[model samples]
Target: MSQLVSLNLPAGTTVPSHADVVIVGGGIMGTSIAFHLAEAGVRNIVLVERAELGTGSSAKPLGGVRATFSDPANIILGQRSLRSFEDFNYRFKTDIGLRKVGYLFLCRSEAEMLDCERSTHIQNGLGSNSRMIAPTEAVEINPFLRKEALVGASFSPDDGFAEPEKVVQAYAEAAVALGVRILEHTEVMDVASADGCIRSVTTNRGTIQTNAVICCAGAWSQRIGEMVDVHLPVTPVRRQIGMTPQLSTPMPTVPFTLDLSTTMYFHNYANGMLLGISNSNQEPGFSRDFSHEWLPEFNAAARICAPALVEPELAQGWAGLYENTPDHNALIGASKTVEGFYYATGFSGHGFLQGPAVGELIRDLYLSRESFLDHSSFSADRFTEATKLFREVHII
Candidate 1:
């Protein structure tokens, strides 16, 4: 947690009056879009952030990356994102701290194990090399796990974790180098549209007249949608994490392990462990205050799943918001009602890992070119349909 490599916009840089594309929210999603758009030869692109980059949920993620999803679209997105992270260091000259040790998802019940098997089958079909493993094999992969506690587990060697803040900064710096204007501390007041198309974006700095505006605002996406009269179904749910004090003894190299039954997840971080448990009673809003009441429950879960590790004192903990939707999936692509407005929010808790591929997809959508990944399933229009929405079952 040392000081992040500076990637801020130059001092006293003025906001432009017009641009080809305007992106709101400077988190992983927005910065990723800016980088990809600029890489694709879009020069006059502006990314405006109300705060510093990665100040939102992007900075608070557990940094888990996996392709073991029930939905094919999500699996494809994960695969492409993994590829991007693999090449990020070479492309950006910045190491994103990607650790591809693996992702181990443990299921306690037979029903959950069946779901894992089904998801693993779908993932393998889509070129994801994830597979259901025996409880003993799960222990073999990560010796710290309690094998008796897991009914089954699915693991993907290609899936792992990365430094979220570093990834965001890398994307922002690369975007700046490629001619994308990044305006930090600039609040987007309103998005003015005429005849169902974006006309201009009024911000605290100044008004930028642009035909296209991408809403990558993480937790604030709903408000951004309101600016354009689009009812984006996104809510901000607070998620908290606790970091244990660095252990005296060297711990086993563990993958990002998640107990699917309890929704408790943890992974190795530095010389300690970073862990969190999903609060079933968590109310949706923008409040990010950390609560100590959940500590006992989280401790119990850790004891059950990882009995090898003693309950070390929590060095520190913090809370962050998740841009959740009606379904746990993200809302990507253009709005049916708004002609020039695009969306790339509501990833629930998976935005950071999926940010890179989403950026490419958004760039393709903006240019009206064929996307590398099919994004029809992620359209904003899906919410209006009577059919059941695709929910990601592997969410931690």
Candidate 2:
């Protein structure tokens, strides 16, 4: 399989002189948040990015957009985002190519199957259409299958994947049309503040004189937080994504399949298929280079789940970084250290699917509107003192 290459943006322009709100990073999270803010009538918003928009982790492939998560927060977040994706074509006047290919979590043990069944019940309760299918029934969903390795799985028909760049562009273009200024290839070098509130944001291009700043810098959020004396536990972890060659044999109508035993997932990638495997010893850094050693492990894991992957002459791969938090959840909402400083980062690997919902939440919080979802659970304050632990067993 081919390897994933790093694509960084050119050196950004100098920071702007002034703006009402300054947002750092122009990935899916930043653009979505900017779009929602513009929709909420925050006209004078400035989004600063070190490189071209969505070139970071957002540009990576295997865009599986699913709402059938084991965690309630993830389920709700994905559901809201799915609505936005369904309406994206009309909203942006551009086809983002969101295909409802479905999601299936392959179970390995009775305990895993029970957890999936329980999660499916919760999903149904929350108005999400997800069902637990037997191993035999799963083959109907995807005709080609080695039934021995598979037990049962949770299937969500409405879930799917989309073009990441198109979605990011749609949000950016829409936000711009609404009077939001996005400064691409512009880096925020220093975050200036005073008296527990933001004073200004200094970028490579120029200094944005804004009391309000949203640090959507993804993996680099920890450094930004340090500028304000706040210790955010967000870190960057590398994740590899791969696509297998289009087989001559008719491919089954496969849902996004995950092997519970190996934490590896493979799903339909456009016309072909895409897969990803977790590394227990992934180096922690900002590097986006693909590793050759990881592919064999991923291939073995994929074959164990779907024996079809063992066929030679079919595989391509790429790697990207995931901003992970202590609990493998995102850190959203206002900062307890600084008053006007807000943050939305550390989404782990689920950033793309959760983008729109997070955008709406940030918009509501910024505009002082009543939000339908309770975001207090996602606040950065949870890192300090006692708090509730959000467990999401279904992660790949």
Candidate 3:
């Protein structure tokens, strides 16, 4: 595997007055884009972040990475990302804590089983190693699961999880080593464009003269787009996660398991269990305050799906934002209204896993090179018409 030589700048470096390309957001997505752009020989690239890198939703993800998806686009992206993670330690010289324990989707109803079958068929056709399995087999893979609640399941052994913060640091350090400049604690105040073309970007520290800007702001993407008069259909939805006290027994070697009926998921973390459940009642906003109000719903689902975790003392918890779109798919590609302005946000809740692939895709689009995968499905213009959008079925 190829590796990028580090050229990181000293800490507290001054911000430059100009750059060839100015990328907003220092999270995983922005750093990935910056690294790929530098690899593509784009000189004088600058990445500006309002806070420390990975402090946003990227730092708080479950870190699940998988190729099993109902959509071919997502499957391809996930597969490519998995490859990157597999080579991360050697390529970036950093341990990302990648574990290939796999992903298990338990289906309790016939309708859910059918959905899994359909998704498995689509995934298998696209070279994904996902397959449908009987309920007994699911228990064999994850002995802690309640077999009575699952009629069937779909699983992919290639799926796993990683450390999101480590991934971000690797990308940022590598990008800097390749001549990319990173400006932390710098906020983009406004974007200046004329005649539908980007000219420069204004930040609280200073202004950067550039012809291109890529918004990878995640949950704050809507506000970033508003600076240039483009309406981004992204909303911030709060998702909470809880961690249980260390178990007295050894942790199970089970995959990251999800109950399809309740959208509850859990996986072993160190000696404890990390768990979370999707809440439809979560209002769209930017508030990330963690709450224990959803403990009842989580405990109920745990009793049915993962009985061993029932009534486990919750030791810690957190809330993070998901940049969601109407279709729950990502928004990528260039904007029609703003020339030289591009976006690669709105991954719903899967941005961390897709960051590497999306970065390459954005680099290809910006450099006028043919992309490795078709990105028309994720184009921003898809929402222009009243057409039905493609939705991913395996969302947790």
Candidate 4:
């Protein structure tokens, strides 16, 4: 976790008086949106970041990129983003250190195993290489797992991880080259509108008049949406991850692996391992400090799943936020209440992996073009709809 290689682009001093489009948030989400819009010939694009680019959750992620999901929307988003990451080097002229070690989810019970198989069917139908596997096969793939503990698993060789910071840097750099003005250290104070449409954005630096504005504000999107009278139920829940020192006894490189029951996941990192577990008791807020407060819970779950993990002390670690929605899915659509206001937030923990394709999706939505996937199910308005909330079947 050394300092990230600087994006090294010239800085802009003044916020523009007007822009063709104003993008809030400067993480991979906003930067990717900017890149896509600029690539589509959208001019006067302005991206605003309160701090430097790639702050908050985008700054720290295990970077596990995967398309293995029970939900069609998530599966499609992941599949498309995997293709973008694969072609990123040719398009952006930078190596993102992508490791296609694949992803494997270990299931403990008949219920969990049944769910994995069911999800695998959906994944395979969407042209993914994922398939359900026996406990023995799952152990063969990762070798670190206890075969007796795992009843079943699902794996896809095409899904893997990459450096998230690099992706953000690439998109920001490319967007800047495409004439997108990125205003770092500038914070948005208010969003002004008239006649149910966006009129301008007021920031700490200055106000910029723009007809269109998209909220890519990640975990803080709830606040941003409120400014425009839009309800974007994005809550900031901190997720922590830690890396182990290089193992004394070299372990076989394995795919990104997760225990479905406990949500304890681990993957190879710096010749050691990156480990994380969801704190079920975690409150929704913006606390990004890594702590041992959840160690007891993680240790209890680790014993049940991976006995080899002897509560290894993870002294070096960082915490990041997950822009969680009520049903743990994404909110990607325009606002009916506020015209010229759009959003793409609340991916739960899937934002980083889905950023690339989502950029294109948001760009198309902005331009009123047809998107590859039907985004109706993902609209923010569904929260108030009479029907039941759309939920993702498999999550980690």
- Per-residue error for 15 in candidate 3, Å, reads 3.3
Q: Select the stronger candidate by TM-score from 3 and 4.
A: 4
**What are the RMSD figures for all models against the true structure?**
4.5, 5.4, 5.0, 4.3
Each prediction's whole-model lDDT (CA): 0.86, 0.81, 0.87, 0.87
For residues 1-396, write the lDDT of model 3, one tens digit per residue: 122243323455546788989999988899999999999999999998887788887977458999888888999999999999999999999998899999999999999989999999999898888989998999999998888888999999999899898899899988998899887778899999999999999987778899999999989998989999977789999999898888789877789998988888889787888888887678889999999866777789988988877776889998998999999999998988889899999999899899999999999999988988988899878886434333333331
Candidate 4: misplaced stretches above 4 Å?
1-13, 387-396
Q: Which candidate, 2 or 4, has the higher TM-score?
A: 4
User: Which ten residues in a row are the worst by lDDT in model 1?
Assistant: 387-396
The candidate maximizing TM-score is 4
Clash pairs, candidate 3, are: 6-177, 7-177
Give Cα distance to truth, residue 386, candidate 1, Å: 3.3
lDDT of 2 by residue, 174-262 (tens): 88888888776677778888887898987766677888999898998999888887666888888887776877776666877777778
Q: Residue-wise lDDT of candidate 1 within 1-396, one digit each (tens)?
A: 233343444566557999989999999999999998998998899999898888898887458887778989998889999999999889888888899989999989999999988999999998888988899999999887888898989998998999898888888888888888888888999999999888999988789999999999988999999988887789898888888888789867888888897788888887888888887778888887887656676768878878755464688888999899888899998988888999999999999889999999999998899988888888767776633333343342
Q: What range of 10 consecutive residues in model 4 has the weakest lDDT sum?
A: 1-10
TM-scores, each model vs. reference: 0.93, 0.91, 0.93, 0.94
Model 1 pairs whose backbones collide: none
lDDT by residue (281-313, candidate 4, tens digit) is: 899888887887776777787787677775876
- Pairs in clash, predicted candidate 4: none
Candidate 1 segments exceeding 4 Å error? 1-14, 308-311, 387-396
